[model samples]
Target: MAAVRKSTNWFAIGVTAAVLVVVLIVAGVVWFANSQATSPGTLPESSAVNTETGAIAVGSGDKTVDTYIDFMCPVCNQFEQAYGPTLDQLVASDEITLNIHPISILDRASQGTEYSTRSASAAYCVAVDDAANVPAFVKALYAQQPSENTAGLDDATLASVAASVGASDAATSCISDGTYTRFVTAMTQNTPVQPGSGGIATPTIAVNGTVLSNQTDLTGDPQKDIVDRLNG
Candidate 1:
């Protein structure tokens, strides 16, 4: 009888423990869901303002286009991957002047690490120090945005990436020092972005500060918008 009672007690204890665990797990899920909805702490998108240095020129054909992009954004990466080569061609041909602005509005984490923003800041620093190869540096970073929480980018990686794009140490150091924080900040907070005509998500291409592809003004493929203006 004693042994049987002991076994029964053990079973009851195990059941109680399991119930408590299930309760805790359910509560945790609720809390995490709430947190995710609130602020998952992702960095905000980059801003699209440039009252200071002015917007980038469109392809060299007397047309100027300003493009606002966030470094941490997957779509932004897709844009770079897809349209970067085409834009490079246009830039090489002097068909358009390009102003690429880094907007920072999507980098936040529970650990207070503004991942995307930091990368952007680094890239901005690169640009501030060396105005010529900003595009190349941006291409490099976007090309290798590691999965979140794996490992953050360090200065050495940035330097190597910069060097790969022909940026010298002096220029790379500027990226490390983050000298363009204010410039990048303004691009996010105070910068006034011209709306693309259609409401398509960003990686927006604007010609001479006018957004021709926003939902409102989308006449056609953004490239066509500028091409028409260029041909005219």
Candidate 2:
């Protein structure tokens, strides 16, 4: 894209992004459903969300998938586009729950990481009023995911995008205030691999207790679709 021009110092984005995306997708196995504790039960490892109670496992199914995604990441956008329909079906059938843990790899990989964090956290503020809107808002952001280091979406545009989904101006205001920087930081630092999940990049998905490594996290096998039966 013109925005993510090659003229700049974007040479650094060479192989890291490609490698990161591939590993995350084809590496995970499955999340442990037997355990209720916060620890990683066994092999296949897990991508977890550190919660108040314990480590919350996530993914997509009749149960739940603890999803860790970055807003400004292209792969994340692709995942949403491919799998979001399945998510809607699951929500309708009340068969699956997505505990999405949005992080900020945009800064690490793209320039929009910080802005994406703001946009995401702002959506969180909006979700406080209506939780269903977060997915829709996230979908929009991903649809607009540009190359790394592109900027222009200020607080107003972000808020507008949020409002289009359901978030209010007040929620947008809260996002602009930059309250969730810590959450974003914590997300980036998460490894999300066998050892951990902090160091990993965006769109890291964990089903039940199993971290999926079969296909691309962005465009997986669409388990949500199987349950929904919205096929052609």
**Local distance difference test scores for all models:** 0.61, 0.58
lDDT of 1 by residue, 98-164 (tens): 8876766655521345655566666655554455667778878887876544445666786788788
- Give one digit per residue, the lDDT tens place, for model 2 in 1-232: 4676557555557677888887776654233322323342211112333433122332344576556676777767777777778767766666666677766656644453466666556555555545657677777777666566777366777778888887776767666776545545544455366224434655666655566542433335585433323331
Worst 10 residues of 2 by lDDT: 36-45
Best by lDDT: 1
TM-scores for all predictions: 0.62, 0.63
Q: Which residues of candidate 1, in runs, are more than 4 Å off?
A: 1-60, 109-111, 147-152, 190-201, 213-226, 229-232
Which residue runs of candidate 2 sit more than 4 Å off their true CA positions? 1-62, 109-113, 187-191, 194-199, 214-220, 223-232
- Could you tell me how far off, in angstroms, the CA of residue 191 lies in candidate 2 after the best superposition? 5.8
